[model samples]
Target chain A: NAGVTQTPKFHILKIGQSMTLQCTQDMNHNYMYWYRQDPGMGLKLIYYSVGAGITDKGEVPNGYNVSRSTTEDFPLRLELAAPSQTSVYFCASSYGGASTDTQYFGPGTRLTVL
Target chain B: EDQVTQSPEALRLQEGESSSLNCSYTVSGLRGLFWYRQDPGKGPEFLFTLYSAGEEKEKERLKATLTKKESFLHITAPKPEDSATYLCAVQSPGGGSYIPTFGRGTSLIVHP
Candidate 1:
């Protein structure tokens, strides 16, 4: 089963260019999250959604936005991207509460901002 | 703010060697702790979840144990494929959100 899928496995963006990272999951999970992982750093949450149309800012939400129009899809938008935004983006989904369920992650989207 | 700290930024172990990684956290009220393994250029893969203190979970050559202030991931006779960065996260309630804090992670390299 295609548990979780992300688009544009690799991309290169110029400074100030905007792009969206697409994420979809087939697990019918209630919780979905967007995170960025930098070299030698851990994953940092950018935004999350509990269900459709229910989204919230996470630890590092600045310069990023997320929308959950449906349970199977959560997209992350980057406006006026900067070189600091260059990192591997990951999308995760969980079935139950964040504290009680196991989070399954997508392959990842490697973005390079120049 | 919730905080999670993992010990040993990097570790090198010989094949078939046993070792342990530590994940320590401090939060207002912890709901649960999670362990994940992330390979290079890939997202994290869930390993284990510890709900409360004195809990333990095991799979294959890895075992995880939790305590009030920390958690341990013990690897027994590890192989090269087992080499990866291990991340630790903690879930807690704050204000009205259930935000989890993550650690920098421990990078393990197993040599054959």
Candidate 2:
């Protein structure tokens, strides 16, 4: 089903630079999420979408933005990147919005901001 | 605030050894508890979900047990391939969002 896929498996950005982390799921999931994982830390939600056109902030949404224009695509935008943004990012999707729904995750993107 | 804490940040076991990883959580009301396994340089893979206290779920070589305050992941007869970071998370009914709060995770290494 292709499950969930993320683009740019690795990247390095300079301070003040911007980039978009792309996420797509072929499972037709109605729920999509963006999370960041620092070394030795648990995943922290950056943003999430219930469906296309409905997005919400999560635990750590600063310096990030998200747009879900289609059920299959959810992209996270980092504007004016900072060194603190250096972390591994993951994209996940689920069939429903309930907490019990199993989440399928993509191979993470390792980002380094200098 | 919902919080999850996994104990024994890391563990090393010889192949065929058995052990358990602990996850303790604090939340206003628990909606679900989840277990995921993550290999190095890869994303997390869902293992199991427990919706209520006293609930139990099992997969090959892994059994997850949930209580009112904590969850335990028991790995039976572990193999070297079972080496990975095991994560725990809790979900609370938060105004319908129900975002999960995750623990740092327990890293396990089984040597052949």
Candidate 3:
């Protein structure tokens, strides 16, 4: 079903450059999330959306912004990127919340900010 | 605050061997504990979900059990294909948000 797809499997950015990581789901799910996995660290949520037009910040959202303008798409924006933002980003979607159901994750995008 | 900790940062098992990976957590109130398998350079794939103490679930050669303070993912008759990083996550009730707290994960290497 192409559960969840993330664009730019790999990316490189300068310290002050900005870029948006695009994610899309074809499962018609109601929940979508953006998470970053640093080396030797667990995936940390950056932002999430419950449904179209509704979004919220997560554990590590200071350098990121997100928008869910459509049920199928959720985009995470990195502004004035820093080396700290260089991590593998994954986009996931679920039929319900983590407390209720399983989440499907994308292949992930490896971002390197120098 | 919700937190998850997985034990045995890395494990190596011989073919036909059986071992268990541990995931311990602390939370205001437990909603669910999840297990996922992540291959190198790939995102995590969901494995099992344990909602309460004494609850158990199994798939193929993998079995997951939960307790009030921790969860165990038991692997039986390991194979090279089963080698990967096993992650655990917890969902707490107080956040008003549904984000789950994840552990650093246990890297499993099953040698043939």
Q: Estimate the TM-score of every prediction.
A: 0.95, 0.96, 0.95
Worst 10 residues of 1 chain B by lDDT: B92-101
Candidate 2 per-residue C-alpha lDDT over B1-112 given as tens digits, one digit per residue, 9 for 90 to 100 = 8989998899999999999999999998887899999999999999999999888999999999999999999999999999999999888876687777889999999999
The candidate with the higher TM-score, 1 or 2, is 2
TM-score of chain B of each: 0.97, 0.97, 0.97
Query: Arrange candidates by DockQ, highest first: which order?
Result: 2, 3, 1
lDDT of all the models against the reference?
Answer: 0.91, 0.93, 0.91
DockQ of each model vs. true complex: 0.66, 0.75, 0.67
- Name the candidate, 1 or 2, with the larger lDDT value: 2
Give fnat for candidates 1, 2 and onward, in order: 0.64, 0.69, 0.64
Candidate 3, residue B32: the lDDT equals 87
RMSD of 2: 1.2
Judged by DockQ cut-offs, the docking class of candidate 1 is medium
Q: What is the TM-score of chain B in candidate 1?
A: 0.97
lDDT of 3 by residue, B33-68 (tens): 999999999999999988889999999999999999
Worst 10 residues of 2 chain A by lDDT: A94-103
Model 2, range A1-114, lDDT digits (tens) per residue?
788999999999999999999999999989899999998888999999999999999989999999999999999999999999999999998876554777899999999999
Q: What digit string (tens of lDDT, one per residue) describes model 1 on residues B28-68?
A: 88888999999887888999989999999999999999999
